[model samples]
Target: MHSQYKSRQGHTTLGNTKTTVAAPSWISDFKEITKMRLSISVVFSSLVGYLLGVDVIDFKILGLLALGGYFMVGASNGFNQIIEKDLDALMERTKNRPVPSGRMSVNTAFIISSIFTVLGIIILYSINKQTAMFGAISIFLYTCAYTPLKTKTPLAVFVGAIPGAIPFMLGWVAATDDFGIEPGTLFALQFFWQFPHFWAIGWFLYEDYKKAGFFMLPTGKQDKGTAVQTIMYTIWTILISIIPVFGFTGTLQLSIVAAILVFAVGIWMLYYAIRLFKLMSVKAARQLMIVSVSYITLVQIIYVVDKFIR
Candidate 1:
């Protein structure tokens, strides 16, 4: 009987040991740390630029551009997290992030970020010198300048928009190795789009941002002034988005039909921005945010489709 009990005890102990040895979920943790969804969205913008610029659509170059864009954005995000870990811990939305939540050490995060930065620059460099240079600049501006500036002043949004706009133009540069009116137009579209999108986020997350002392909204409050600025920038975004149809953007020309479609979408976005100005409520801001995202995505789709159809 005692021998039988010893065998059962051994089995239970083995089961306990097996249960205690949990496997590391490095992939999921890495995704959270790098903000994979946001990185993917940025990569999509670069791919859109590449698709618009490339004549023959080389899948190999396209793949490299997407990969390089993701790595660069990922590295920027990781570095941003490391620098803002303490501040992030104070914010409800960011408190659960890998660095702030103690799921990942800063040293490990830094090492991973370094690897991503090196790989990203090399991948972009393989495409072209200009692409690599812009990739590096995007990372530098995002991590070094925009990340810290969030707490200092609302103007960080403008600074942040520089790197934010780079991906859209980077694809064009990757394809042509040139920065001309075409890429400039792409940069301008994205640069203006960020204001409304970011301000909408700032409006709704005012309290959360306040927890960490981040002054994201213009006027540093969700007042009529901020809403008015959001409206003004939305108008600017709409105006510039249709300028390609006027034939000034060279190879980046848009058909009149595409221009009309883009304008319609812009109008839809503007309606929400106007409503936000009138209502000045969180709901209106949220609606504006959703419409703004749809507007950009639809505009990009229209641009690419217009290219192929034409």
Candidate 2:
């Protein structure tokens, strides 16, 4: 009888241990739902904008801007997941997301998203009304327009780029509290950069995206047309990035050296893009995607560094 009791106790202990080990913490779930890494990248772009616009860097405002940007982007991502929960389950890449995987309830996710949205806007408002307005607009467009349009048409990439490009410009708004040629130039640079960056993603993830009825490429297929379009947009992105060096971007002028470096980075991106066009292979597309990310990151870094040095 004692032996039987001991065995039952052991079984109960093991069961409890397994249950405890399997349950994820609230923080982990929050991070997953918010797409933390993506949110951080968005915040980084906003920070770059703020740095470029401000002659005097206020760490307090900078911190608030980063926090605000993160919350807004987090809210957008959370709402997107909630809206696309069913579609997410169909795609292997998104199947394990918190909402679709049954780890988070829709009602709970919605509430969290709402809280973040309010918090984000309030924080941005602390910076300035224009900054807050742009943040709110970004959230609205991303959640309402971009999220829903994904499954309906490939034009979703174009719609999505609007909100994506806003972050960089939003920072300038936060700093200057005005939308002018400087912020507009920043917006144009990021606006055109999205094409090659996202099309490469679309090309490589064609199978996964198709599983969920998302067509992100312009031609709706991994064809030479899409590759050619990617090349064209890359050229546009390169051209726009160097416009500041020509003394046409108001107060946001890049030095000749900075422009040269930026052009070289653009060439690097274009080289990979051309390779993708020639090879028309998934591997080449993946390479372009990587180079595209590096290109933008390097360009932003060079711009900021040039501002300080010259």
lDDT per residue for candidate 2 within 212-234, as digits (tens), equals 89979998999999999999999
Tell me the spans in candidate 1 whose CA falls farther than 4 Å from its real position: 1-24
Residue by residue across 139-229, what tens digits does model 1's lDDT show? 9999999999999999999999999999999999999999999999999999999999999999998999999999999999989999999
Cα lDDT for residue 134, model 2? 94
The lDDT of each candidate is 0.92, 0.91
How does candidate 2 score on lDDT?
A: 0.91
- Displacement of the residue 152 alpha carbon in candidate 1, Å: 0.6
- The predictions' CA RMSDs to the true structure, in order, are 6.6, 5.8
* TM-score, every prediction: 0.94, 0.93
